[model samples]
Target: MSLSRLVQRLRHAALCAAVGLMAAVPAAHAQSDADAGAFPAKPLRFIVPYPPGGPLDLMARALGEKVRASLGQPVIIENRAGAGGNIGADVAAKAAPDGYTLVMGAVATHAINPWLYASLPYDPIKDFAPITLVAAVPNVLVMNKEFAQANGIASVADLIAYGKRHPGRLNYGSGGNGSAGHLAGELLKARAGLDALHVPYQGAAPAQLALLSGQSDFMFDNLAAAAPLIRDGKVQALAVTTLARSSLLADVPTIDESGVPGFDLGTWFGVFATGGTPEPVVQKLNQAYVQALRQPDIVDRLRVMGSQAQPLSAQDFARMVAAEKEKYREIVKLSGASIN
Candidate 1:
């Protein structure tokens, strides 16, 4: 037993530690590769941040069914409806970035909520990896048939003229204070320089009922929900709240074309994964959702529901979201819409 024997023992121990560390590095890399290849090895949680039976929920279920066939995994729809879709969006934002969790993000969640909410739980642009846009539904300017007839408001121009003449007399009803319908009404007021009272109901159905019962003068109603009422001569359709006319309401003009220049708004929703999801997985999700959107049945169903499915690539979708968010920032500020 000497100093030389002790030094040899130390050297042998150091070499063994180095060998073990090298082996562990390779094993870690192998595990990572395996995980990368197993994209969506289990069911995916598809969050629809609204209540069931709505367009977003129905479309999510349809897309989930279609994608399940191709991805070989079930897409579970999780409706987390509250705080104007912020709760569900926050859930998806904080979820693991393994591409298994996705949220059906909408204009409200990604664009409007960021600006409306006093403190948002997540950054819409930074916290999500865009998959693809699912659908866009146009809002229609509909008035009670009796109100329009009695007031001589046969078109958007007439309504604007009457509103300007009557000032605070013409009132509009919406789903809620900060809802898209309310915002649309506010935008209309701003654009046309008309003064109208905003009457907010607990939900769109209630707002539409107010309009139908003549409790409210008019409303910015979802075209899908108002289409039947309009067809039945219960409500009079004036114009759609989109730059482009809705195919379902072929004869109707857009607010942009109805004397309110530069006016455009719609309900648009899409899919988004956790921000740090791998690029390949994002692309795969885009393809799957876009494919589902392009299906003949899906296309027809959306058309019937007054929604248009125009899917875009993931990069393009991201750009669209960014642009829309900026657009809504100004709109929300102008509307003075806020949430605590």
Candidate 2:
């Protein structure tokens, strides 16, 4: 054979060997897909980026109890709270894309924290695959019952007027800097053109305590946690932070209806796995959580907690997360909030 033909034959043999080798071992990519196909074949670790007893932890525990039954594996709850949920979220983000690790991602984890921290440990959009939105609860603008009565504040309008009159004297407390409560207060301030001071506490419970102790005049707090206080007459609900009235609190009007037209804000909890998790795994998770939410006991318990179970498909949930992320970005800009 000529030299050129010999060189061509050698290249053909090399290409055949490469193809055989490629067919022989599909290492990194094939294993994960195989694992996902048999997803949750073993116990899964569920991370809640908050301490036990908080709403996120409670929701995870509630859903985990049911999902584990369907998954046929224990769903272990791990609390990794810190850095406004960034610590735990980063852990989830950096975790193996194997289908075993999941996180109960909250508004802070997937939406607000990215904007609040100048250098976030995780990328909300890039680091995780949204399984589904678990639930959304309204936030109620509330004040100490005695404080409202003493100040003669009867409604959203009254509160705004009082703030205007008192200017910086009206103080509001929040779970922490850039928390939903803080942003709600800032939103109200911008919409109503009131002058008020923002006080940040360690957590929602502490912020509510500040209100009860009269250290702060008011706060926008989760209806689930604040509803009992409102019902027991410890705190008075001024208006809910939603465009529409919360079904659990029908008697209370929405901020849009009360005085601030077009006002709407609320908190959401969702499930997410590391970004490259197999889509099949994500769909499986979405189905489990959706079915879990539909359980009568879960529905009843959520209602009692002042929230409703929202079961959306993975696609729909992704759209919701995207919109919320945009909304939070705007709010963070408007409020000029940053952890740095």
Candidate 3:
């Protein structure tokens, strides 16, 4: 072979290697542009699936403050309360998969509704992308101070005694059928051998209203939603519906520790974007909320409202959602609660 020919062959090999390297590394400009425009271009919408003062709503507002500071965009809170969070969840699920839209979802919307409804509109796992879980707030057994004082019902024991004494006479109100509140009441009846009638209302706010109006005897309300009312002496806290005591209500005993021995049930809130949102967008969202949940003030505030922040990665959140769905399936079946 001639020397010039060999030099030409080496030149060809060098050109091929250069092309391969360019292909292996994506274009720098494309990557930089994506990084710059990942998220936070405009104001983001945060939909709360319940009334304004509920635990899910409180978490959305609290986390929104920290997330806006980090993401450099205003976070707007929209209240779409109805059908035990189904109305808002359906709206969020159908929103564009763009990262600008997100919903503060609850166990009732994602896990229990599908099991309870015969023809549910949205598919929880298929229609949303899991972001971090904001917190797990337990249910607190609450009654109007007026009724409690009149009846001398001071604690869980007293409430249980009254319930057993009057089977169909005792009534409890919940957000709606198949809601965490409703299921919690059923669980209480099953465990404590009480014959309490289940009263379903439009939302937690109205259910609480019914309790205060003396339309209902007692209720299991989210601790955060009942916090202000409880603090204001509008309602009395009998017991928290978790096996372990709630940090926010340290003075309140767990239902398990009360008379029921092993009563454990509660609700959790998590952030979710429309399914099919870009993976990078989802990651950015998870990072923002998780970071906010870790902040000292945010963490402390949530805990104070009975929303104990539980930050989780996207994968972990997805796994947790699946497990929660399965767990609630049996609960719904046993309770025989359904909507539409």
Best by TM-score: 1
After superposition, which runs of candidate 2 have C-alpha atoms over 4 Å from their true positions? 1-36
Whole-model lDDT per candidate: 0.87, 0.83, 0.82
Candidate 2, 85: how far from true, in Å?
0.8
Predicted candidate 3 versus true structure: per-residue lDDT over 1-340, tens digit per residue: 2112222344466467668788655675466448647576899999998789755676689889989999999999999987767889998999999888899988878888889988878999999999877777788999978888988999988988987777778899998888788898888888778888999997778999999999998999878778788888999899998766887788989887887865667777789999988877887888889899889998888778776667777766776787778878878987888767
Residue pairs clashing in model 3 are none
lDDT tens string, model 1, 1-340?
A: 2112222344466467768789586776566556568777899999988899888899899999999998899999999999999999999999999899999999999999998999999999999999988777889999989989988999889998998788779889999978999999999988898789999899999999899899999999989999999888899999998777888999999888889887878888889999999886887788788889999999998999887677777876787788788888888998887888
Q: Is candidate 1 or candidate 3 better by TM-score?
A: 1
RMSD of 2: 13.6
Location of the lowest summed lDDT over 10 successive residues in candidate 3:
1-10
TM-score of each: 0.89, 0.87, 0.78
Residue pairs clashing, model 1? none
Which candidate tops lDDT?
1
In the order shown, what is each candidate's alpha-carbon RMSD? Answer: 15.4, 13.6, 13.8
Could you give me the TM-score of model 3 versus the true structure? Answer: 0.78
Per-residue lDDT of candidate 2, residues 1-340 (tens digit):
2112222354466467668788655673466457567777889999998889887788899899999998888999999988888888899999998768999998888888878898987889888888877777788999878889998998999998988788677889998878899899898889999788899998889999989999998999889888888888898899998766777889999888887877878777889989888876887888788899999998887787677787766766676677778878888888888988
